[model samples]
Structures are given as structure tokens and as C-alpha cells.
Target: MTRVLITGATGQVGRELVEVFADLEVTALDRAHLDVTHRDDVLDVVRRLRPHVVVNAAAWTDVDGCESDPERAHRVNAESVRWLTEATREVGGHLCHISTDYVFDGTARRPYREDDATNPRSVYGRSKLAGELELDPSATLVRTSWVFGRYGSNVVGTVLRLLDAGAPLRFVDDQVGCPTEAYDLALTIRGLVDARHAGPVHVTNDEPMSWFGFVQRVAAAAGGDPEQVEPIQTADLVPPRPAPRPPYSVLDGSLLHSLDTTAPGDLDRAIERVVAAMRSTVKR
Candidate 1:
């Protein structure tokens, strides 16, 4: 049996990875059980398990919050990655690290390639980029965007909650990127691990669309009124957020194209499944 260790096992992507990797010998550790910042704990765990692969799904994702405390953000997002990478290397296991589209500044009109020059705008992006930089050349890096799914708070879940409360929604129309489902991302990571693919790969549901369009799809999936969701410019946010978002975050599908890996299904279809799963739990 293949032994796979998953860090950040309580996170949205991590949770899905745990479920999907049930057939494998999986040892999942949430923040409580395995804090990545502590090098001793991380090294000890990896040395003990000696897993074939280590999937790092943990990250400090609070964009605006990262600005408030850059130190903490770096510690959680970047510094901890250093220790994790070292630990993974010590165990002679391949590391699969999760990254974000934020590694790029939103200036590019075309989709960003893996080799593209990185210039992150916010502290969160810089920290994540630092994590990417710390990875061993042999480690696999998966950069994803606009993730939503069953285990944690995400754009889809937020829209559903607001719709349930009958709260008016106004999403930014200027910002656009791929909307990825956590389950799909987890499956893709599994394939990459099995193949031991190295270097950065972009994984997201196909097509590029704004958050407004995404919310509309979510509303429709949840059997709510899509037209009720309003569109607004990023500047029009009532209370401005602290971190700046990339206006165009579409990552180039070049790597996925070269590998001939099938892209995840349409964003709307994934949204429907996520909504359905959420609804099932509400009734029980």
C-alpha cells in the first residue's frame, strides 16, 4: 500500500484529498495535530511515517488578514513551507505543495505560464510565492484559483448562506479567473503524485469568468434567483478590503495540455454537485 501523508488535512482541499485517498495508506494531520511552523514536530512526523508522498494543502488564505499581520502570514504560509520541504526531503518522499494564482501581479492580459515572471501585489501573494520558491526542484507545485467545495468556507458557500438569509449580493465583475472545485483539485493532485510529475502545474475548471458570473452560477445551482445577484466594480466595495486582488488570474493550461490530462468538468456542473452535497447535510 502507498503511504500518503496529507498536511492541512482539515482544509477544504485537504479534506477532499483525505476522502479521495481512502484506498491508500493515508495519514492526515490537521493544524492541531501537526503545526507546520514547528520544524521539530514536522521533521519527527515525516521521519516516522516515511510516506511515499506528502501533499501540503495547508496555507494562510485570508488575503486581507495577511496584510494586518505580515509576520504571521509569512510564518504560516512561507516559513512553515521551508520546514515542510526539508522534512519531506528527509523522508525521501515527493512533496506536492499547493500554491495560488496570486503569485502574479494582475497586469498580464494573457494567461500566466509556469515560467512567467512572478510579481505578487499583496503580502499574502508574496508569502505564497516564497513558499513556492522554497520547494525542492523535484517537488510538484499545483497552483489553483477561486476554490470552493464541501469542507470549508468558500465563495460558493458564502453565496448560499447569503441567499438563504435573503441578503443582497454584489460581486466584483472586473476580476476574472478559473473557479476550481476542491474535489477535482484533490483528484488532479492524486494523479500528479502517482506520476511523480515535477514542477508547477495549474489546475482549475476550464473557462475564465468574473466572480459575478460565478455567483450567478452558484445561485442557479442552489435553485435560487441568479438575477438577484448584482454586479459592481472592485472600487465600489462599500468598505474596501485590505489586500489587492489580481484582476486577471487565468493560469495558462499549457502544462495540463502537454500532459494530456483531462480538465475538470465545467464550473457550473461542479457547483451543482457541491450545492447538492451541502443540501444533503442540511436535511439530515
Candidate 2:
């Protein structure tokens, strides 16, 4: 069995990774156990384990919080990645790090490609880009957008919660991107890790739509009326968001095909599964 070391194992993606890699020899660790920002500690852990692959799923993902604390964001997102790169090198292991579509400044009319020029507009995006720069082409860099999953706080869960409570749904129509199911993404990551794929790659669900449409889809999947979702512009936000999200973040998933792979099945099917699973837990 392939030995895999996963950081941020408690996160949405991290949790799904653990579940998907159940057959493998996996060592999953959370921030409390392994503070990746500490260089010596990260090096010590990797050097000791010497796993075949080290999946760095840990990240400071609070976009607005990153804007307020740029230094902390760089430390966790960029500096920690440098440490992980060095550690993985010491063990002669493949490093699979997760990245965001936020690296691209939402200005492209066409889908963003792997080689597209990146101009991140917010502190969080800039920090993530810095981390991406730390890796050589030998490492696998997966850039995804609008990621959601069953294990953590995500837009999917948020929508379900609001719908269950009979709350209003207001979403921005201007910002568009792909929604990635974490379980499927984890499966792709496993494939990449097994193949020891190198270079930057984009992975996301099939459909590309705006946030408003996405919320409506979620509401519909949860047995709520899609029309109940209020469409609003980004500028109409009462208290403006701290970080500026990309207006268009649909990635060119064609890169996955080049790697002899493809995105998982239909996005609507995935959404329905998530909705069913979430609803099952609701108290009658």
C-alpha cells in the first residue's frame, strides 16, 4: 500500500482525502498536531516518515481574514509551503499541494488556462500565488475554485442550512466559477499522486456558472424553490466583502485530459448526493 501523509486532514478536502485513501497507509494530521508554519517541525515530520507522497492540503483559507492579516496569511500559505517543499525533497517524495483559482485576477473573458497570466487582486490570492511559485515543475500543483464538501463550512452546507431554516438566499450574479466536489477532487489527487504527475493542473466540476445560479441550484437540490434565491450584484452587498473575488474563475479543466484523466461525473448528480446526505442528518 502507498504511504501518504496528509496535512490539514480535518478540513473539508482533507477529510475527503482521508476517506478516499482508506486503502492506503495514510497519516492524516490537523493544524493542532502539525503546525506547518514551523519549518523545523515540518522538516522533522517528513524526514521521519519518509512517505511516498506528502499531500499538503493545509491552508489559511479565510479570504477576508487574510486581507486583515497579510503577514499571517503569507506565513501559513507561502512560507509553510516552502518548508513543505524542502521537507518533501529531503524524503525524495512527491508533493501534491492544493491551490486556488484566486491566483487569476477574474478579468479573462475565456476560461483561465494553467499558463494564463496571473494577477491576484487580494492579499489571500497574492499569498497563494507566492506559495505556488515555491514549487518546481516536478511537484504537482492543483488549482481549483469554489470548492465545497460535506466535512466543513462551505457554500453548499451554508445553502442547505439557510434553506432548512427558511432563510432568505441572496447571492452575487457577477462572480462566476466552477464548483468542485471535494470527494471527486480527492480521487483525482490520488490519481495524480499515483502517476507522480508534475506541473500545475486545474480540476473542477463540469459546469461553470455564476454564484446566483449556483445558490439556486443548491436550493433546488434541497427541495426548495430556485426562484427563492435573490439575485444581487457584488456592489449591492450591504457591508462590502474584504477580499475581491474573481468575476470569472472557470478554469480550463482540459489540463486534466492531458494528464490522462478527466473530472468526475455530472455536477448536478454530485449536488444531489450532497443534499441528500445533508438532509439525512436533519432531525424530524
Candidate 3:
């Protein structure tokens, strides 16, 4: 039996990972059980569990918060990953670290390749990129974008809530990226772990869309009026954020194809699934 350990178990991706790896001897830990910022606690847990695989799903994801508190972001995103990597190395366990498409500057005319230069504009992206660099040969880094799922707060949920409240929705049209489903991303990670594939990989849905388009799709799926969702350029939504976001951050997962890996669903199907899941939850 392969023993697998996951941090940020209560998060969107981590929650999905627990469900996907349910058959395995999986130990899921949330912030309370495993505070990644505490090096001693991280090392002690890894030494005791001695898992064959460690999936790090915890991250400082608040884009604006990272800009205000860069030190905390570094502690959570970079330093904690280093500690986890060291612990995993000591235990002879392979690490799977989650990353983001924000690593790229989004200036590419097409999707970003694995080897493309990363010039992250935000503190969150920089910290995540730093974590990726720290892992090197010992870990597999999976970069994804526009993540949404049933387990936690995501774009889909926010859009639905706004629609329900009859609040006018305004989404940025300038930004574009693959809207990845957390469940699909989690399953892809499971495949990599099971197959023992190494190195960095990009896993996202087949298509890319602007934030406005995504909201339109979500609204349509939820039986809401798509026209009510307004599309606006990022520039109009100022006071401007503390950190800069990439205008285009789509990641190409062609490398995963060589490894015989396939993304689960496309954007349309992912939206349908999210809508169905949300409806089911509401009915319950």
C-alpha cells in the first residue's frame, strides 16, 4: 500500500485530492494539523508519517494580500516548500507541489511552454515560482490556472452568489487563461503519482477564455441572464491592485501528452459540471 500525505486538505485542490486518493492510505492535514510555516512541525510530521508521496496543496493564494505582506507570503509559499522538500528528501518520498500559471508574464502570443521564462508580476506568483525553483529534481510541479471546484470558494461560486443576489456582475475582459477544474487537476496529480512521472507539468482544460466569457458561461449554465454580466477592461477597475496580474497566462500541456496524460474535460463541460454540483448542493 502506498502511503500518501497531503497538506491543505480542506482547500479546493486538496479536498479533491482526498477524494481521488480515497483508496490509498492517504493522510490529509489542514492548517490546524499541519502549519507549513512552522519548519519543526513540518519536519516532525514527515518524519513520523514517512509517506511515499507528499502532495503540497497549501499556498498563499491571496494575490492582493501577498503584495501587502510579502514576508508572510514567502514564509507560507517558499520557505515552507523548502522545509517540505527537505523532509520529503530525508524520508525518501517524492513531492508533488501545486503551482500557478501566474509564473508567466502573460506576454506570449500563444500558450506558455514548460521551459518559458517566468516573470511573475505579483508577490503570490513570485513566491510560488520560488517554491518551484526550490523543489528542483526531487519534486513534480503542476501549474494550472483559473481553478474552480465544488469543495471550496471559487469563481463559479462567487458568480452564482452574485447572480442569486441580483447584483450586477462586471468581469475583466483583458485577462485570458485556461479555466481549470480542481477535480480534474487533482485526478491528473493522482495519475502522475501512480505512474511515478517526474518533473514539471501543466494541467488545464483544453480551452482558454477571458474572465467575462467565463462568467457568461457560468451565468448561462445557472439559468441566469448572461447579458447581466458586464465585461470591462482591467484598467477600469482601479484604484488598481497592489500587484500586477498577467494579461495572458495560458499554459500549454503538450508535454503531458508525451507522458500519455490527458486532461479530464474542456471548459464547457467543466462549467456544466460545476453548475450541476452547485445545484445539487443547494437542493441538499
How far residue 163's Cα lies from its native spot in candidate 3, in Å, is 1.3
Of models 1 and 3, which has the larger TM-score?
Answer: 1
Candidate 3 worst ten-residue window by lDDT: 260-269
Give the alpha-carbon lDDT of every model.
Answer: 0.91, 0.90, 0.90
Query: lDDT by residue for model 1 over 226-262, one digit each (tens)?
Result: 9999999999997998999999999987787678455
Model 2 Cα lDDT, one tens digit per residue, 214-241: 9999888888999999999999998999
Candidate 1 least-lDDT 10 residues: 257-266
Tell me the lDDT of model 3 at 43. 97
Considering lDDT, which of the candidate structures 2 and 3 is the better prediction for this target?
2
- The C-alpha TM-scores of every prediction are 0.97, 0.97, 0.97
- Backbone clash total for model 2 is 0
Q: Given candidate 1, what's the lDDT at residue 11? A: 97
Sorted by lDDT, highest first, which candidate order results? 1, 2, 3
Rate residue 108 of model 3 by lDDT.
94
